[model samples]
Target: SATLRIELSRPSSSEFTFDERVNRSHCSVSVTNMSQQSLAALVIAYSILKRRRKSEQKRSCWVKPWIMQQSEFSACSMLAKELRIEDPLQFRNFVRMSSQQLQLMVELLGPIIGKKDTKFRTAISVHDRVMVTLRFLASGDSYNSLQYLFRIPTCTIGSKGTIVQKYEVFPDTREEWQRHAEAFNVQWNFPHCLGALDGKHIVIQAPANGGSHYFNYKGTHSIVLLGVANANYQFTYIDVRCNGRVSDGGVFQNCSLYDLLENGSASLPDHEPLPGRNMPVPHFFVADDAFAIRSYILKPYPFRDQPAPNRIFNYKLSRARRIVENAFGIMANKFRVLRKPINLSADITANIVLAVCALHNFLLSTRDSRENYLTPGVADSEHPETHEIIPGNWREDSTSGNSFFSLERGKRDNYTTSQRDVREEFKEYFMTPSGEVAWQYRHIV
Candidate 1:
């Protein structure tokens, strides 16, 4: 039998019913040969019915009631809490500027940090959050206390957390910190200085074993050392190896900075060569009598008689040296760890120190004006003067040596007793500037 193929035409309404009945047999045989118009009409009808069913299902599954209920829930409510913004514009402005500064640091350290994970992909930029966290730490509030202020997680506040690790991109090297200081210097005003130097202790939970070494004379355990700060009080150098038993002088001597100074390799910023001199030896740091005297390291002059000019020079130097002391004070007050005893691993303690110093610099650099974070009952005006004997010049007696100070003997005993004698001698020398102020001497005693 042959497969028959036929065509059928159907018209609208009553005409289609009559045609279908009349051609029922033919229509059954020719269904496969229907016209393109008939096929198109069938597809259109199916699509319309599908859309209607989908619309009805969507209407039945509406979530407006649940959404409204959620909105009414106290936890889901959005409340705009009023906050005191010192300068809403200031932080944004600083972010724009600081981002450029941070980029420069990345460029200079490109070879080292470029290959490592940058880790800056959070909603808050890593650098901005780090800077903010540091400011909070330096300002000296408890970690739990800063939740409302910074809107950061409590876990992110300390050195061991995600926030700090993400931001600690640079290596803990003197050169690296120096580069950071250079960047900070560009943004802040600190003349004749690369960075400020101070020491701080980071408190920790007591170690389970061999923890006695961390204990210090203050009846607490700590790691004592020196930190280099920019004029804005940011750390450019941090040495945290010295045991808490060591003095600042001991820490400096053990640090690579002392070796750099001794070998004449350390470079000072903006230092000009002496007139008619081939290479300018960098100017040394300003320290109390704790450090050795080199042409580079400047210390206050020991008290001497008859010269008001020298005394004036010493006074100015002492005033300048106070920047470091004030820097240390600020560090201690801002991070209660320094005020309290530290009890952590030496490495962690060191990291805490660096982190705190970095934060101090950040706060000092960002703040409109720098002020000491003084303790209660401690007046800003009451900072005591630190007296240092000019090393290599303290003489036991005028007749015994051409110079008054004995550097050789002082070095042996760690300069402990000798420091006392030098202070006394300076007091005596100052009392008799052309004439005796006997009553003033009484006041000093």
Candidate 2:
């Protein structure tokens, strides 16, 4: 009986003081002195009038008179260079893309997000939606600011913009991943390094009475974005939907990719002999010590050992795994939304992250990126350890990661013999003359 009783809490204080605000009239309606049919008709007509009045009031609140005055400086006429954006620096500062990049995005997103008008409501033009969404991504401006600046309905700009963002962020081809592995082999001389793996926390405002379901150790609420990126700074595979409290390893264990890796369904590369060696090592993703050693995954040795082999191994692995860090930096710097906490639901935030990942890959593919526009939080030259990992953006996650995949194995040895075998073999190889890089020794020793 006590549990069944409802409890009401005091409302939180608001920025606008309620003392001088308009008070709503509390009254009842009555109709009399008419036949039953006539009275019912009169009531229905009054109801319709009330509904219309409420709708008009809501419309007036969002749609301002200033929009009409600013029609001359609309998105296309002012932003697209119709009025001529004389300063290239100014253009990049506002929209976060060059004129050429904007045109390319318009072409790419047009077919996917375009729609037709129905009898009920007019359809928004694809141009307006694309440009505004890009502007939001680049500048991290509030939805209200975008609505007023672009002179479009806030609801349309936000809703349709999210629709464009829902497209899957995974690569169109598996070849893209293979290309990344090849690049690591040729450029970094880190053979069999298929990709760099890592996880980032996408911060969001905690839901009411959320407790700790969204809380992370960083004292913030977030959803984990676990991604595998290649040497070209393109995301090859990503798991966008996971609880924030999940660790880098916890997210990895829960995803279907882990099962694929376990069952050999991932179609990984063959075991080719090490250069000038008789033994063959299978292709694998390089992650940090946050991840456990696995047959198809590698990590640096713990800080305890003082062996030269371990030092060299850590150096080589660090060089390879650092790619994912740089990739995340480039993405957050370019798409400012990731730089700050997203004041949206976890589901919507996931979509925004995925869409930006897809867009980042698209941009990386189309251009050389000699002059990428990067902000401070996420820059190309940023070192992962020195940076705060997107500070002032972590949210509180209440969910515990106890039920995540790794726990299913039970608490026996925490690791299997095969896991140890994999790490040992890789360690020995990096110490060998064929696998050793000259700069590695200077840094490690």
Candidate 3:
């Protein structure tokens, strides 16, 4: 029972073996018993076997010379070129600027965006930094979404904390307002029109402990961007990153743009006579029913009764005011980011809003080659081009401002005597020969 027996009737010898045969329960082996050449052969064979196995099956890894060598900028350029994205429109749709414009942009903003020196540490190229920032702003796409396309840690580049800086983007100046007024007068025939004012709710995640603070009447969490856009759909005055719950009127009342207007620092053009009349009309910001009617900010009369004059007022105001809608529509269409909710903090949201607005102004300044594709007509609730203010029969009152002061005055609860007078003046002005449109009577319901 003490003897251990193993039965192998016919044993076979295998290659590359260091063999030992057990003789008893307590067995001992001596190195002197084995031949030196045999031991050397075993060692060599074992080593060869290990190397062969390693050669046959090795650990998988991903690495390539080209991938390792190319930087982010080089890679992006190579990709854009390889895809044949040469056309301006194609480039605009992809990265929101033409190739030339992109180069000029890199020249302008490069040094300021941390591309100053790479002698001390490895730094990202200016082109790479700007392209990433632009792509983020134009598409409203997230850093995670762009990784596969750009092969970069996009969230880390050109941003302090997921925010493109506001100082980099330029807003409309006093001269810009003059230019905007000229454009509105020339194109839409609405003289002294500074820009169309509107607000859009940029949806966002429920802020930390932000219960209803961000909840809007639209039944969504958002930050409102109140933009005053010129006829070319460029933002002249931007009141960005307001609470989503605030009304258009509320935003206007509280914004710095409005403050400038109130404090007389906006340097707006003085009240000027209408094109066909001597009564000077003050430059005003066009808005919808969401805003209160003011001497400087004109809104359409309440859409209740069917007076010929009131209908004309609605039609005319709608004609000019719808530009805001068109501007917002074009912006949302171009930057699909506006169409989706942005998931970021308030500070970051404000910075992003500023950047997008600036990009809008840049594109407008550059002027897109394809006219109809990017320039949408004024948006109307009823139709794209709803009001036809060319000509019609409502020209009964020919004398300008005649009997305009004596019209029936029904006002909103908040309207003061002077505010009502301004609205009435505009209404009668439309009924007068100077303000009347030939199609006013024809379009009336």
What TM-score, over all chains together, does every model reach? 0.45, 0.74, 0.69
The numbered model that scores best in lDDT is 2
The list of candidate 3 runs beyond 4 A from truth reads: 1-75, 84-89, 116-121, 158-179, 272-281, 368-413
Query: How close to the true structure is residue 277 of candidate 2, measured as C-alpha lDDT?
Result: 69
Query: In candidate 3, how many Å is residue 302 off?
Result: 0.6
Question: What's the true lDDT of residue 127 in model 3?
Answer: 75
**How would you encode candidate 2's per-residue C-alpha lDDT over 273-307 as one tens digit per residue?**
67776667677899876666677887776665668
lDDT score, candidate 2: 0.66
Candidate 3, after superposition: displacement of residue 62 in Å? 16
Candidate lDDT (C-alpha), each: 0.44, 0.66, 0.61
Higher-ranked by TM-score: 2 or 3:
2
Q: Model 2 segments beyond 4 Å from truth?
A: 1-64, 68-71, 79-84, 115-123, 163-178, 369-415
lDDT of 1 by residue, 1-445 (tens): 2233333433555555643543332222334555677667656655665564445342333333433243233111222111113443343232222333444433433443222334432233343344444444434446665544455445544542322222223224555445644543243221133444445444444456845765554455556657654444444566667765555455678787778767755654444432333333343355556565555555565545635535644554454455565566555544544544334466765666666655455445433423322323321232234333222211111321211111111142233444444333333433444323322322232
Clashes of each: 13, 17, 4
